[model samples]
Target: MTPQTQPAPAPSPTQATAGTRRGRRPSLGAVALYPATFLALLVVAWFAVTTTGLVQPYIIPSPVDTWKAFTDNPEYLWGHTLVTTGETLAGFVIAAVVGVLVAVLMVYSPTLEKTFYPLILFAQVIPKIAIAPLFVVWLGFGASPKVLVAVLMAFFPVVISGISGLRSVDPELLELTSTMGASRIKTFWKVRFPAALPELLSGLKVAATLAVTGAVVGEFVGANSGLGFVILQANGNIDTAMLFAALIIMSALGVLLFAIIQVAETLLIPWHASRRNRG
Candidate 1:
């Protein structure tokens, strides 16, 4: 009698997931098509409304008018954009460094976490805009206040995400590392930090955008230069086209910062499941 052939083994979940990712990987053009389509629709709607006089030109300038505003004084706008960008970057860097360090400290010390977490939450709840003027008063009407506001806007999310990530390490894995005679620092560096990166990077992306808003808000309070200043000037003079142009530039700056963080996440955590799935 011929022996029955052995049955094939089922694919493991990991193998199945890997196969799914490979199958679902999107082409560059496919990935871009959705946003491009949406943007085109928006442009069509905008043109229709403006050309048909459904929306007043004073309230919502035509695309041509906005383009003219940019072309008219490109250098003036560029200088202000650079000023805002610098403030945003400076604040974001400071917030990131301080936030991570604070998170590490709180994680390592239960007493510190217990004492400071509530206070942190309280501070977070207070409107940063309300306190922004105070910073302006203290730091003066310069980049200092804008950067400070940005730091405040960005700091909380980083700290919260850092705490979540740091605490998520498996106790069993930690014990195993300890049993292997690994130092706490070695385990943390090799295992804990790597595990924490996905959450940390997510927080950074949010913080990056908030930092831009904070800079603009501070500029609104009092600024000689920046997109916010340009917007304020255009608003007072009823230059709707220039106002729209400044708003667009401000939005672009925030998007640019967010995209940079996304690129960083891709580079730093290519091994993570999120990154793998995206790929």
Candidate 2:
């Protein structure tokens, strides 16, 4: 009797690419190490360059100065942060609901798309920032204008992505479903809709991230509250430290909001691409 040997399987493209790309699955220590090292090097370089007087300290504050500023007026900064957070969240919710509805309508009626696509294209072309002042005049210096601006900023990508997702259903599968005497609604709900989901979710993620940026911009142009308002006030006061603090806060808020959307999308479409992502 002879013993047989089984050879090992080859590595997948993803596994090979993952090592080259993300590398080592990113443990918490590695996560802390990279940014800390980069920032440390950056700080050292900054200290050397500034101390040498190549760039004045007034022009670029030290990392220590920025840290001091962040801790100085934590209470005052917190209030403005809440305002910006509110605007970002409100606009994201509105955009999500409207984006999905518009996508659904567009999918159901090609004529609706023909009627509306040009309008959306035109709206997108007319830069939101340019008409931000007009929004103030029309909607006043309230949160409504800010929310509207954010919604406009986030809407287009979602619609386009959703439509593309809906249309991406496999033709053969659709034909098979149709031949099986499925109704248009039934086919779409059971087959096409599920098929389109991952793409739509991906688009939603993009839209969610953009919405935060738009909300901040809206507040910057017109409002007496929120981080944008805080930024304006800090600029006026020449309070560099507070301004830097507010900027950091605004960035953190954006990242947090984007993460929330990703979480929601994962929860909603748990059985889809995200599951494969976990695997």
Candidate 3:
């Protein structure tokens, strides 16, 4: 009689997902096409509306005028953009470091989590604009206030996502690590942190965009420089083209930060399900 053949073991969920992604992975150009098409359509509509006088040029400046505005004073705008970018980066770094630390502490200590979670929620709910003045008052009319506001705006998501990720580790895996005589720190570094990374990165992407907004809001409260200041000045002078240009630059800054975070996520968590799906 012929020897009976044994069936192969089924692939795990992660492996299966990775296999699917490998099969369906799209080219970079294919991935970019949809957004590029949409942008082209939007530009076309913008040109049509402006040229046809459907919207007053004063209210929404023509694309050509906006481009001219940016080109006319590129240096001035670039300087202010650099200032805002600095504030945003500073605040994001602080928020990310502090948020991760707070998350770790809360995870390790149930009492701390119970005590501070409500306060954190309350702080998040209060409008940043209302509190921006307080920061300006306390920190004065410099970059400090802007950075502080950015930290506040970007902190919540990091903490929430961190908590969710830290808690998501499998109990069985943790038990195995413990049985193998791994220290708590080792277990956390090797297993918990990696497991938590996907959620943490998601939160970080959101925080990155919010940091830009926070910096701008801080500028709105009382800043002499930054894109926000440029926007304010353009508004006051009724320079609609300059205002549109400033707004466009501000949006681009946020998108840039978001894209950087997304690249980081892709590099850091290539094995995560979300990344696999995107692949």
Candidate 4:
């Protein structure tokens, strides 16, 4: 009878090293192939429909025509993009600061939590769009209103996540810290806060997306500048291509900001379970 044998072991060290190096090197052609294919398909489909006279030119501009619009007045769109991005970043920072502090306080002091928790929940249910006009009236057609609106929209997620994180300390860990004669503040800083980090980061990601929406809403209400204002102006004049371009830019900005946050989270919490899974 032939001798039974186990499967070969994973490659020895030198071969494994070579395999990893090949995999790690970024491939430009591979990255570009699929997106270019899809883009070509989209253009062909759009041209076919528009050229067939099935739709009016103004109702659905061809890809070539949209390109012309984008190239012709890029400066105008870029200026408004800057304004929207600035407001989003500002409001996001404020929300992060205040949300963390409030959540921490709530976690530590039941009285403080009970006092404002109901009011905070009530405020969250109020319609954001309805408050848009009020923000414009109170803060006027400036950056303040846009920033505040963004802050309001993004703050809740951070607060909600932070509370859950701060309070999720294991009872066993708490008892261990107590047996070691650690003070409450010391135990919190050394043990509790670190445990909560993964949840807080997940919440931050949600807040980042909402923050962009808030800035746009703020612009829609009364601003003379910004992506939202640009959309309104473009719609009034029926400049659909520019409107779409502005929206695309806003989407890119949001994605970039959120990506940065995710990268930071990965770096700061490498030992956390989610980060390990991501790796």
Candidate 5:
């Protein structure tokens, strides 16, 4: 006679505890260690290259020299940093606002998308630097041209990503909302806008970095102040250490802006898959 086999017994508390331990993810500090280690190694290599005279001081200044350059002209550097920062911030805000509105209009109207998308692509293709001087001529050497350059640099990414995000809502979900007799505007705010935030944030991160570049480019073309101007002056004077210091500040600025966007993304969409994965 065939006998029915008994089901396997549930795991014991001790076995379940061991399984949980084995499946545990690395802590945040542990995850951060890898980048910290690499950065430390890079700094060590930089110091060695300069201190050992492998590269001339004039060509590649030591970290100590770069630090001294900043200390030597604190006010000058601080003022220029503020100017560039303002330009970058203004450009980013304008891009985010105008780009999103344009994206919404385009998404709701196919004809607008077809008409403007190619024009945007065309504008993006033209070298911003080449036309930056024209803006200087139009708006003068003041901050307006620089801010405009930043806006142009940041605008494309926002519009592209905004359009993509706004249209990516699940059609079935949209239909479900429609069946519930929700107004189009109500459906958009409650469903589409929230659904599109992740993609929009992704674009904003890219635009943030590019905004720095745009501001610097505008300064390069014509500016009485800014990190770009400092770099240019340092190059003219053959002050490699000062140039390096300005470059370091610019890099830090870009990184800081990008980090701000990432924080906003986390706060705004804690439920997004990207944030969940990081957690």
Candidate 6:
């Protein structure tokens, strides 16, 4: 008998598409390299501008001075950073729970949607800055106010995206699920919720970053602690370097939280188009 050879499996759609673009598209490392190089150049320009006295030190502190600010007083900055992080995490968690619950209620009940959806939109339009003080008054000058402010800032996006996601389920699929004798709760959990994960996660990622801003805003308005307070104090004292350091820390915190959400999205829904595209 003649020896037989097994044929190779056909490439998948993703593989074929990737192959087609391999020559045209920049490699992942190249894409990353460009950003890294750009950032390095930016830092070099910043250092040059400050060191060469192109900008006044009081106006734009040198990067070395900014580094010194953190090194000289690590305890002060680190403590405030931890406090801000805690408030942000607390507010984000609360917003996620409330937003998802509200989305589910609106999706399931037309009455609730008709009555409450407009109200929710109205609430979003009301400036959180105008209301941040009220929370401080009602909840006292504590973490409560900061957390509430963060919640207000982050809540709407999650609710809106979640509602869209849940409602995006194909009506035909829902009908089929009903015909198959699945209960409403079962259908939602098994089909609708999963279908909505991508949009919901996108909203959460936005909310996560907003939560940081909200926390800082609350601290700016009232709190005596946190990076926001540090910035405020630095401004009053003309400590531009310290102010820059605080700002840098806040930006890093937001980036860290957003990155965490991205990781969670990948882990939770590896099959999502966004995750697959990244791959």
Best by TM-score: 3
Q: Which has the higher lDDT value, candidate number 5 or candidate number 6?
A: 5
Residue-level lDDT of model 4, residues 39-145, one tens digit each, is 88988998998888888877887777778777998898788888999999998989988999999999988999999899778777887878989988898899999
| Candidate lDDT (C-alpha), each | 0.91, 0.80, 0.93, 0.85, 0.91, 0.90
Best-to-worst TM-score order: 3, 1, 5, 6, 4, 2
Clashing pairs in 1: none
All candidates: TM-score: 0.90, 0.80, 0.92, 0.82, 0.89, 0.89
Better of 3 and 5 by lDDT: 3
Evaluated at residue 165, the lDDT of candidate 6 is 96
RMSD of 6: 5.1
Candidate 1 lDDT over 32-79, as tens digits, reads 899999999998898899989999999999988999999999999999
lDDT of 3 by residue, 1-279 (tens): 956587766778886566564576787799889999999999999999999999999998889999999899999999999999999999999999999999999999999999999999998999998999999999999999999999999999999999999999999999999789989999999999999999999999899999999999999999999988999999999999999988888899999999898879877887888877665
Model 4, poorest ten-residue lDDT window?
A: 17-26
Flag regions of model 2 displaced more than 4 Å.
1-40, 43-54, 180-183, 264-279
Give per-candidate clash totals.
Answer: 0, 0, 0, 0, 0, 0
Reference-based TM-score, model 4: 0.82
Candidate 4 or 6, higher TM-score? 6
Residues 1-279, candidate 6, lDDT per residue (tens digit)?
855577766778787666442245456587579879998998999999999999999999998999999999999999999999999999999999999999999988999999999999998999888888888889887898999999988999999999999988889999899789988889989999999999999999999999999999888889889888999999999999999999999999998999899779867876677666653
The reply for model 4, stretches above 4 Å from the true place, is 1-53
Candidate 6, superposed: residue stretches over 4 Å from native: 1-31
The residue-by-residue lDDT of candidate 2 on 70-177, one tens digit each, is 687777788888887788788888887898789889888989989998998898888888878888999999998889988998888888888899888888998898
**Over all chains combined, what TM-score does candidate 1 have?**
0.90
